[model samples]
Target: MTIILAHRGSAGTHPENTMESFVAAEQFGADGIELDVHLTLDGDIAVIHDTTVDRTTDGNGRVTDFTMEELKKFKANYHYKHFFKKTARIPSLKEVFEWMKGNNLICNIELKNNELPYEGLEEKVISLIKEYKYEKRIVISSFNHYSLVYIVNNWPEIETAPLYSDLLYKPWEYANSLNSKGIHPKLKSVSDTIIKTTMENGISVRPYTVNKERDIKRLLQINCSAIITDFPEKAVKLKRK
Candidate 1:
C-alpha cells in the first residue's frame, strides 16, 4: 500500500509541528506523520522546522537560541490565530513520542541538522527511540547523509533514510551505500523511471511536500511506496479513488 504521511502533521491546515496538527493528522487517517526536530538550548529535541521559532511561533529567535521552557512560552498557533480557534505550543520530541503511546501510526522523524548541526543529535534521538522501543515504528531521516550514516553506525537496528532535495545519479545505489531502506526526494524529482528503479532495487521512494490532488493521483498510479503531503486527508481520499 502507498502510505500517506502527513507532512509536518497536516501543515497546511494546522500550525505545523504542533501537537494539535499531529492529532489532526491522525484523525485525518494518515498512515504516517513526518516532522522535523532541532536541539534546543536546554538539550530538548524541539519539533519545529526552521532553525528558529520566528515563522511558526509568535517568538522571533532561533530555536537553538531558546531553552525548552522559553520555546514553550510562544504559542504555536500564532500564524493561524484568526483562522483557527484552539492553540498549541511547540512540542518536544519526547512529548511527541509520549503522545504516540496508544497510536500505531508510522512516525518519520527528520533531523534538521543538514546545516547548523547540534552535537550529539543522533544519540539524543536514539535514546528517545530506545526509551519508547519504537524501532519498528520510527524512521529517522535527514538531508545530511552523514547523520543517517551515524545513526546506522551507532544503532544498527534503527531505520534510517536520506532526504535529498535534488535528483541524484542512481539514488537507490546511493541509499544502498549508506545502508538506507528508502529515499525522501523532493516531489519534482520523482518520476515513473525513478520509482521503478527504486522499487526494482528493493528500496522505497517517498517524495516530500506532495499536496496537490493530481500529483497524489499520479504517484499512486505509479505505485510509489508512500507520499509526504501537507494534507493527508485529501491525498488519502484521492488514493481511495
Candidate 2:
C-alpha cells in the first residue's frame, strides 16, 4: 500500500506544523506526518514552512529576524475554520520532538534552506533524534544537497530522502550520489519512465502534493512507495479500495 503521509500535518485542516495539526493527522489515521524546520537567529530550531512569516503567520519579517519568544506572539494562519477556532502559533523543533516521543506517528522532517543555511543543523537534528531515541521512526529530507550529505555522513542510520523539482533532470542520480534511501519529487514532475528508472536503481520514489483521486490512482498504479498530500484522509480512503 502507498503510505499516506500527511503533508504538513493535515495542512488542509489545521495550521501546518503546529501540534494541533500533528495530533489531528494522527487521529485521522495518516501513516506519517511531514513538516519543515528552520533555524532561528538565536540558533533554536522552529517548525515552519517558509523562510519568512508573511504568508503563514501574522508577523512581517524573515523567520531568522525573530527570536522564539518574538515568534510566539505572531498568530499562525488557520486554514480550517470548523476544526479550530483560533490558529496556533509556530512551534519549536524541540517541542515537536517531545510530542513525537508520546505519539505513535512517524515524522518526516524537511530542513528549510532559505534562512541562514543552519550550519551543523544536520548534527544538531540528529542529536535530538538520538536524545529522544526516534532514529528509527524519523526520516530527514532536504532540497539542499549539503544538508542531505551531512545527514547521510553523520547519521547514516537514519533514512534520508532528497527532495527534487522539475527544474532538474535525472534527479535520481543526485539521490543516488548521496546514498539516499528514497527520492521525493513533485507528483507532476515524475513520469512513468522516471518512476521505472528510479525504482530500477533501487531507490524508492515518493511524490508530493498529490491530492486528486485520478492522480493518486495513477501513482499507485505505477507502485509509488508513498504519496504525500494535504488531504491524507482522502488518500487513505482512496487507497483502501
Candidate 3:
C-alpha cells in the first residue's frame, strides 16, 4: 500500500507545522506527518518552514534571529488569523517529540538547512529522537545532500532521504551512492522510469506535495512507496478506493 504522509500536518486545513495541525493529521488517520525544522539563535530547534517567520507569523524576522523563548511569543496563525480564531505559536522540537511519543505514528523530519546550514543540527535532532527512542519511527530528509551525507556519516543507523525539486541526472544512483534509504523528489519530477529504477536499486521513491485526486490515483497506479500531501484525508480515502 502507498503510505500517505500529511505534509506539514494537513497544511491545507490547518496552520502548517502547528500542534493542532499535527493532531488533526493523526485524527485523519494519516500514517505519518512531514514537518520542517530550523535551528534557533539560542541553539534550540523550532518547527516551522522557511528561514524566517515573516510569512507565517505575526512577527517579522529570520527564524534563527530569535531565541526559542522569543519565537514562542509570536502567534503562528497570523496568515490564518482572519479565518482561524484559535491561537498557535512556534513549537519546539521537544514539544513535537513529546506529543508524538504518545501516538503510534511516524514523522518525517526535514532539516531546513539548505539555504542556511545549521551547524550540529543533525546531531541535535538525532539526540532528541534518541531520547524518545523514535529512531525506527523517523525519516530525515533535506535538500542539502551535504547535510544528509554528514548525518549518514555520524549516525549510520538513522534513515535519511534527499529532497529535490528539479530533475536529476540519476537520482536513484546518487541516493544509493550516499546510502540513502529513500529519495524524495517533487511529484512532478517523478515518472515510471524513475520509480522503476529506484525500485530496482532497492531504494524507495516517495514524492512530495501531491494534491488532486487524479495525481494521487496516478502515483498509486505506479505503486509508489508513499505520497506526501497537504490533504491526508483526501489521499487516505483515495488510497483505500
Alpha-carbon local distance difference test for all models: 0.91, 0.82, 0.91
Ranking by lDDT: 1, 3, 2
Given candidate 3, what's the lDDT at residue 112? 95
Alpha-carbon shift of residue 81 in model 1 (angstroms) = 1.1
Candidate 2 lands at a TM-score of 0.92
The candidate 3 region of ten consecutive residues with least summed lDDT is 192-201
160-192 in candidate 2: lDDT tens per residue?
998877744776787788989888888878887
* TM-scores of all candidate predictions against the true structure: 0.98, 0.92, 0.97
Tell me the spans in candidate 2 whose CA falls farther than 4 Å from its real position.
Answer: 78-83, 167-171
Clashes of 1: 1
**Residue pairs with backbone atoms closer than 3 Å in model 3 (clashes):** none
Scanning candidate 1 in windows of ten residues, the lowest lDDT window is: 188-197
Better TM-score candidate (2, 3): 3
lDDT of 2 at 125: 80
Error of 1 at 239 (Å): 1.7
Expressed as tens digits, the lDDT of each residue in 110-212 for candidate 1 is 9999888799888999999999999999999998999899899989899888998877889899989999999999988767798888989999888998988
